[model samples]
Target: MARRKTREEIKTQDKWNIEKMYPDNASAEKDLKESVSDAEKYGKYKGHLADSAESLADALIESDRIEQKLERAFVYSRMKLDEDNRAAEQQALYSKAAAAISQVSSLTSFVMPELIRIPEETLKQFIEDEPRLQTYRHLLDSAMRQKDHVLSEKEENILAQLGEVLSAPDQVFTMLNDADMKFGKIKDEEGKETELTHGNYISFMRSQNRQVRKDAYTHCYEAYKGMINTISANYSANVKTDVISARLRNYPSARAAALSSGRIPESVYDNLIDSVHSALPKMYEYVKLRKKLLGLDELKMYDIYVPLVKLPKKKIRFQQAVEIGKEGLAPLGDAYLQQFQKGIDSRWIDIYETEGKTSGAYSFGSYDSDPYVLMNFDSTLEDVFTLVHEMGHSMNSWLTRKTQPYVYGGHSIFTAEVASTVNETLLMKHLLKTESDPEMKKYILNMYLDAFKGTLFRQTMFAEFEKKTHEYAENGGGLTADWMNKTYDELNTEYFGPALSHDDYIQYEWARIPHFYNSFYVYQYATGYSAANAIADRILNGGEKERDDYLKFLSLGSSDYPVELLKVAGVDMSQREPVDRAMKVFSGLVDEFAELMEE
Candidate 1:
């Protein structure tokens, strides 16, 4: 068996230069101390937010500065911890950062409620009178929208101080999943023993060897099955937290509270489900095609992930994958590509999977720091896509932070997902157009089809589960292990249709997903996939105008409402046209796949 590499064993160039954030642990602690001091400075401005235009402007700027320090400190610590969860020193750094952030939150809890106390007319007058406040026009307007939801300063302080407690479920699950639990071992495709990890589980599921896939699937979920009771309890607590927090904030539902900050309408959420529900038949047809190609007596949950258009085994090494990503993303023009290359050269990515590292791909960092990416690269073609997907996210942050003010220096979760998926869509387009191998072309098509199924259909299923489970808890239904398993089982049965048979243990799959910790986040993957398809199509089919427009959209950050911001990129997400267009693209891909296979 090949031993998993430890954090220390990985080469320096292969890892992100997280030290760029702070020179050492002492420097990180110093940053936290600075944040705490800056947060304390907010006390003088607390009750006087509405006093004068200059006073309001100064207070808002100071608040952004305080948050900037706090976020940078927290991000640095969390990234260190994520690199290797088993390291005790890293764990302490993370706990310290988390505690400091909680303290900072409590200190600044008065800003919103106090700002809310000021009359809207007074805020507008302040905006007009204070030239400095002019830059914060959008910020003030956005904060004002939360007027009804802002709790009193004292109550908000209590909630903020309980921040760590509220987040405990996610932290506990992280330790259990990443640090403690083991999925044991399985035989590799070469018939050698290997460990089954959250990182490699998907790669194994993509195996052409059926026995390998089934063993990997069974071994992975059976471990979760063992901890099912504990996981369900944590998950239920997490859901209840969402419900209670939303109610406390006077939201009609938890989902409303989740979306309110982004100013997204409930209709967008409902529209995604309805649109995906309408398109489920297309997904079912794609499934039938998969089963027929595999020539299986009956397909099961394990069978679903294997690519129908099997090609020769080829490992896309990390360096080569980056080159492919660079070429595929060229439509974004020279400026975008230059910064991307610089990030690559500067070690903005943590490139390989190591023992005890977090088991997924994500782009995250503080606004002041480089937008760092953590990936579990396994050299599959899908891993190449994952690389580009994360780079897309980092690029969004890089551009936004470089362009927008500190307060607006991040992409809304809704638009953030679009930025990432657009890269996936564009890469597939580039691959199909450039590659000449008929089999490889078929494979790319298969990948694209599956991306649609995975992002558009699978994530929507997960989204539906989030919505239903939260609603259930809000309605007083208990989320026991048995109940969760039943709910998940029904979703799989409905989504995949008769083409796939069920593995009894597949029901426990929900317990393992980390995104459930972030309520209402998965649906953005679906909605974003839909919106990104439109944006990617426009860029590929149109000219410089489309590409530049899209880049501008990425740079806007949270300066405007997400739906309105999407329009700058020529994608109108406020309407159903984007989802409908994505469905059409899926149907076309399925037809093309059907043709290629028949030939």
Candidate 2:
């Protein structure tokens, strides 16, 4: 096996050009100071938005300018820190940038309440009187939509000041999981001492060697089990924060508060859970198939990730992965293809993993910068799919930035997942249509099935758990470690069904999931995957109208509500149709995979 490259060993061209945001620390510091000054000066608009149309317009414009600059500075610092978290200087830079942003947010906290205070008729007149405000119609409208939720200016300011303190749980969780936690070592198939890490836990789970998978699972969860009490306390505090904030905002539930920010209806969340529960039999069938294929007397949770039919390894280089991704995404049209090519040529991706670099992959940037991707590309088929996935996000960001102004350039996380998952779906379709090797074909089919199982089914299960836990907390129930464990364990059994044996350690899985801190965020993965499946099917089988509609959805950014934007893409997520359609697709894939294996 090839050794992983160190950051210093990786060629310059293979890394993302973060310097494009700032050539040096001195330059970043200069901009940081300028942004702080901008934020300080922005205080002049306090209690003055309702004075005149010109004042309102001026405040909005200046706020946008300050936010854009702060975003650029913050992104630069964040990328630097992610490149190597161990570096104290980079960490300090990130901290300073965060503090600067918090200060800006504190100063501007009164803007919303004051804007909400304007009479609806007067606000409409203000927009009409100041043509400049026309650009922010959606922005103003969204704030006004939350008029009932807006607290007094002083109360809002107090909440804003608590931002860092409120974030303690998430911060503590990150510090423990990423920086301090250790999972010890396990032996690989060849009996080599392999280290277990959060980054490679999934890889271990997917190992064909059942012992390795079992060892990895056991060791990983054992580490979490040791810290379960502490982690549970942190998580409970986080949940209480959510509950308190929601109540303070006059929302009936924490889930409602979280969804309202994206303008997604709580019914959409309910529909996802209900739809997935109705489709659990399909997942049960999937589990049964895996057990039969693996010839296991009884299946365990750790056995779920192993590929049913292992094929000869095919190693793709980074450049080859890029070319394949371009070909896979060609159905989207030439403009998108050209932009993707430009991003690649411009070093928009950090292409390899190195010590201290952040694990996993993400596409990130500001409105003014290129949609940059950070990837630990390893040249496996999984890596190729990841390449296309992040590109999906980048393309969406690229289009949104091009078509919308600064305020609307970033889309909601709900829509963001749809973009990335759509790419994964398209890539699977392209690979399946073109690949000739039967074993490789089976692998791809299994990959699609696994994606559905993980994204659609598993995430919905997580969504359900989050809902139940929040409800428990809202009712004044204590969120103890034993309670969380038992609750999570029961949910795991319910979702996985009778085909698999539930292990006690599996209850600790919730402690390992970092997304739980974000409060009701994982449901979007399930919903977005369902929406993407429906959209991908339309694009593949329908006419130009379908393709154009999806492209328009990408360009919309945050100009429209997420549900409405998805409707424009031909997936009405307000109903259960998309989730039902995705489940049908999963069922068909399972039937196809069984037939292929017989052949």
Model 2 pairs whose backbones collide: none
Which residue runs does candidate 2 get wrong by more than 4 Å? 1-5
For model 2, give the 10-residue run with minimal summed lDDT: 1-10
Clash pairs, candidate 1, are none
Off by over 4 Å in 1: none
Choose the strongest candidate by TM-score.
Answer: 1
lDDT of 2 by residue, 1-599 (tens): 32345799999999999988888866777778888898888889998999999999999999999889889988998888878867788878887887777777788899999999999999999999999999999888999889989999899888887887888898688768866787888887778886776556787788899999999999999999999999999999999999999999999999999998778889889989988888888788889888989999989989999889887666799889889988888888888889888999999999887777777889999999999999887667888889889999999999999999999999898999999999899999999999998888899899999998889888898899899889999999999999999999999998888899778789999998888999899999999998998999899999789999999999999998899899999988888888888888888998898888878
Assess each prediction's global lDDT (C-alpha) against the native: 0.91, 0.89
How accurate locally is residue 53 in candidate 1, as Cα lDDT from 0 to 100? 90
Shift in Å, residue 288, candidate 2: 1.0
Please estimate how well model 2 matches the true structure, expressed as its whole-model Cα lDDT. 0.89
Model 2 backbone overlap count: 0
Best by lDDT: 1
Q: lDDT by residue for model 1 over 236-320, one digit each (tens)?
A: 9999999999999999999999999988988988888898888888888999989899999888889888988778888898899
